[model samples]
Target: MKRIQSGTLRALSNKEEYFETTDLQRSIRQGYASLLSGEIEMPTPFDMGALIGPILNEGTESEFRAELTRRIRRFIHNRHPPLNVDVETVERHLIRRLLRTRKGQTTLSGIGVESSGSSQDWLQGIAPWRAVRDAQKEHSSVLASLGDNTRADIPKNILSHSMASVCGTLSLVPSADISELRSALGPVRTVSERHTQRIVKYLHEHTDWVHKHKSLLGREAPRSILRQRYRAVGMTLLAIWPLKEAIRKWMEDNPTTHLRYAMGQIVRSGQYPSAINDTLARISLIGSGTDGRSAPAGPSGLVTWWQHSA
Candidate 1:
């Protein structure tokens, strides 16, 4: 059995947006399979790191994203306080945010709920740009700029803790699960991680609690305490600088044509079939990469759904 320890594990996301997607060269998460080898057999280790190194080093969008997926997973699963986020809850939040935007569209807050990271990758694949548009708004900056009063009733520790957990949870999802992740990103279908990343980065920027209210009136100690809570998980005030700028820009442009262009770029990346299949073949449609997972299994544990569907 391949162990996670045997390979490099990087869990990362855009700053506080930790663990949006996790892709491992090691296929441990796929399922456990033991080979009945009379003699001990060791499968030669190919450099999965080699597969992702350039992507990491150069940050070509796809390679960078694949690498980002790896780091986020690491951050999520390895944090000190442990993230308790359920992917389902994230999906629910996406839904509520999408639902709320309609009522608040008149106000600047109309664009609060949106997708980020590879979360929107799949949607971008199926229908490209037109499938899901303006489904979620970038509210992180608003959350950050107004961090003082936005969730004032809630403890900074809770807010930071929640975002950290979310970022970490994102790390757990796999690349092939992009579609599953997109479908899970709320009511909107067909999106990409790049889409999710932008939205989330905006959220981190707008809702920067540490940089904003870490020293609010008479709460220096409490602020420190809250900041420390997030720091313990490897998140820091300086991590999301770019995200903040994006939010500021979004704020200036009412219609936010720039933001739309950025989101469109995400959809644009999957213009090739390889990228599309590479993302989709990861889930629902299996049997492509490692262990070419057998056809779907039946209730009786023998018949596969693929047998009928195929």
Candidate 2:
């Protein structure tokens, strides 16, 4: 390989610089290039391979990154006035996911074996990948029943059943990480209804609840969850810094996005405390130590917390 000069090296996007750099970036870049060159058609049913096939030949994961990218790219090209796709945000999500599996493991396919094998065999060989594959299968079926369109309107009964199915499949995975929860819950985002968005929020809260009580539940807390907690704790150092006025201004200027999304932007924007510590603490206490009110059990408790908190 030709030697590349350190002085000449630079990040392709802003978010790329923040994440731990990975060789997978090259493959992802290649995939996008192939799409732009019309070398391949975007896959329907949104197979994982179509997006990452430049590196891995196959996968069965049901994560949204691939499909979301496809939609954003098409929007950019097809919009009459042109759309400004947030390539950095897309790349961040992709990199975080691709970097999850060990660097050299063949499991980087983002799902287990390309072909189906006996469930027992999969469970014995690669439980993590098997769990992801199964959860995706569940999520996919639910989305397909809704016409497989992100913008489709969803009914309450179908939505509830879909949530149950996805979360139930997820519960099968032992000590699932945030990425796995993300994979299981991602399809809900496909339907652009507020109900679906609320579903996503509830799932996040479920994850938070599980993570907080992992010891009692006989599971390990996901690293991402720990990081959020630690980040909240770390923000105390900047408590003395004056940021309330600036944040208020930010909220006023950006009124349309979800508060969580906007806070994430503020936190990642720079060296200021974004007041997410309170939110994290609230999520951490979702299912336990309540104010003498009986909330529904399990994931429904998560939904109840979201409703009450909102």
Candidate 3:
């Protein structure tokens, strides 16, 4: 106002620029104020690596990507404001990161992924003995339901010997290869890396059981039958390996005990009906050795062993 400063005319001529600068300065000051008052919250950087590491360690690449998307969605959903993250975008990022790592590259290479370095740590947790037991269970299930013209059909004697070999090997070494048991002694005796690890775990846990029974259980023919059928044969034998006492008492108590009668006695022993019936069916298949009938006498060694043990 009073002839405003000498160069004021020029400044007024650039009025638009001056006003823009003023607005910018005002915005900066307000931004600082908002920050101090906690109104303009800063975004935290999400750790995509931690989220992706374990997911990559899971089964397949497809599984990893699927899990990644689900997890990212869940993480965003769990946020207070429910972050506006694109799940597919995060999945693509995580997968790209995995593809960059050496371990991830090798794992997704489609060659022995089950035994990859990344998966070995996970596999190490499985018991080798449990693997052997599972394989044995699968074999038993097949044997129990043998059919005509089945390529898996092995002679009863050979099957029995193989079962014994498995028991002896496991009992003595606990980690010996019984891969032959799976293929019925075929040329191909392949075991997956995952199963190999499970066998390793089994050996670790049942080392004591194997050492104690290797000598006694290994030579016993009847024990092979039990091992072939029951998954818990080791524990079962531990409870009642020498059935001399129980057999003697039972013989004295019931001179003319029949398999059917034994089944009846088992049913009346206060156990669950379904359980007892299932057990009786399994036992009757083994048959008792005493009865002169063509069919097995009730309560054979298979029956008596578990009876005393149970």
Candidate 4:
């Protein structure tokens, strides 16, 4: 590579910034389902791939970083606006997951592969991945059931079962670290580690793809509050230091567009906002910690705390 300098270097470094799934996508398919445990979800069957990434940490005896990256890249670009999987994104997922595994955190799929010294409630609370098994079966059934246009179909218990299985099986409760956690959980039968994580790999390959299905498969999918709660998150990135002049000029020039899409949005663009200046001024006037939160108000905005508020 030829030597590049200044702004070019900055742009290159900023190329693969963090991409959160919640922030992407504007439209959603209204229906889909699978026949998991006799319940159907709706349009197309529910694809668990969105909730869970395309790859699972299948406890394979393989070395960590290298194998993980290779598998991840394969999955992200499986469809639609394929994921540009970068080392940073991979590291973000890996580090967070590794920490969670070591710390015994809960996963979306209620399958906790944790062990609290082999306690009754702790281990019993966890369930095996039955959903994944079902998905494998439905994949066969649905293909046989439908033809070209499958726009209308209740989602069969297809991806849900398989994802549940893969997620549940691959997830390990948090211990000291990855290796220690693995050791505590026992031997490294990575391949036979309760169904090797091919499902995750598959999901990765087909990210953002809405599989077409028959009209008859339509049933009830996520709706109302649950749907709203899990709605796609839209983030507004702001520039650093916020020159606030050129943008102001642009807004003045093109008033209609800027007012709706840009203003009052979350300023996650690595910059301080003009709106919070007063809040900072007041904090400084009172000399910090008035809210009983913490010190250093510049970077402190919203801190979500979960406790016994009841």
Q: State which candidate has the highest TM-score.
A: 3
Question: Which has the higher lDDT value, candidate number 1 or candidate number 4?
Answer: 1
Q: Which stretches in model 3 have alpha-carbon errors above 4 Å?
A: 1-178, 181-196, 200-232, 235-271, 287-310
| Top candidate when judged by lDDT against the true structure | 2
Using lDDT as the measure, name the better of candidate 1 and candidate 2: 2
Candidate 3 C-alpha lDDT tens digits along 1-310: 3224322322244232222244555676699688556687744543221232234422444565677888886664343322456432342343233224423333234521122222112112222223333444454455456465432333221123233323322321112233422322121112333443333333333322221112243553111111212224322211121232233244347756632234335435544444434333322332211233232233343343333311
**What TM-score would candidate 4 get against the native?**
0.17
- Per-residue alpha-carbon lDDT of candidate 4 for residues 61-89, written as tens digits (9 for 90 to 100): 34344566776645443422323443223
lDDT of 2: 0.34
lDDT of each: 0.30, 0.34, 0.33, 0.28
Ranking by lDDT: 2, 3, 1, 4
Model 1: what TM-score?
Answer: 0.19
lDDT of 4: 0.28
* RMSD (CA, angstroms), candidate 3: 24.8
Q: Give the per-residue lDDT digits (tens) of candidate 1, residues 83-202.
A: 344433343355445434423433223433122222222222221111112212323324445545444532232123334333322322221132343443332122345554433443
Q: Give the alpha carbon lDDT tens digit for every residue of 87-117 in model 2.
A: 3234334433433431323312443213211
How many clashes (backbone N, Cα, C below 3 Å) per candidate? Answer: 46, 1, 12, 42
